[model samples]
Target: MRMHTRIVPLAMTTALLAGGTAAMATGAAGAAEPKGDVTAQSCYGSARNYTGTPGGPGRNAHWPATGTYAYATRNCTDINLKVNYTRDVRVCFKNTGQCNGWKKAKKGVWKVAASNVRDGAGFYIQFKGANRSTGKIAY
Candidate 1:
């Protein structure tokens, strides 16, 4: 009888943990869709912005510059995984001619995608941009 009491609670706890894991998995699986294409937002307010003037290829005082910024589109549409952007930003830039083929033509500009997770609502990313000739993310 004593064994039965111990087993009952153990079984219950195991069941709960299992259920929680399943719930999380379900959430992650839900966001596995193609997600179409990831996009980067133009420079704007905040220190990350670099659309004002042009800077040479070498690093600058600004944190994130504009140019051929490359990053993977990351979406945390799942319930289990928390957005791990604190370390490194991961995302595929939603390429647009608006930046004028900084990616397709390989203008030589390099940009890193911010790990900012999208709420699956109105999410936008910001990457590097260049003057097309210099291949630097000065703007």
Candidate 2:
């Protein structure tokens, strides 16, 4: 009998790396609605608000039900987040359950509407511990 070694796929490896990237950030999300995906501020603001249905177009949509995003609370987990632009390239908490309300982001394609500042700003660390916006931005 011949023994075979199992090797993890490159895609899987990339995913693992991505999940471990959030903790390495050096900024925070703002409040009052994120202005953009790549802002100069950190997401240490109203990221939790991203999960609630505040009733509006700036909300995080609905997650898996009306979208694809889930819910979690990593506080600095790692995952594949992005500056979605389903409407205008918004900054979502791509951690894990971050942007589940919408579909998975496509390569070079925008998925989120736009960084409402008070709306965006959250994290999802690999489908675990997802956090929403905190509404701490000073716009």
Best model per TM-score:
1
**Model 2 poorest 10 in a row by lDDT:** 125-134
Give candidate 1's TM-score: 0.26
* Residue-wise C-alpha lDDT for candidate 2, range 1-139, written one tens digit per residue: 1222224466677787787665444233324455765332343332332222222344433232333444333332222233222221132455433443333444333233323323334432111122232221121
Please report how far candidate 1 places residue 99 from its true position, in Å: 20
* Candidate 1 Cα outliers beyond 4 Å, as residue runs: 31-139
Cα displacement (Å) at residue 23, model 1: 0.5
Once model 2 is optimally superposed onto the true structure by TM-score, how far is the C-alpha of residue 134 displaced, in angstroms?
26
lDDT, candidates in the order shown:
0.33, 0.33
Backbone clashes under 3 angstroms, per model: 20, 54
Residue 99 in model 2: shift from native, Å? 6.2
- lDDT by residue (tens digit), candidate 1, 93-132: 3344331121222323334333243343222222234221
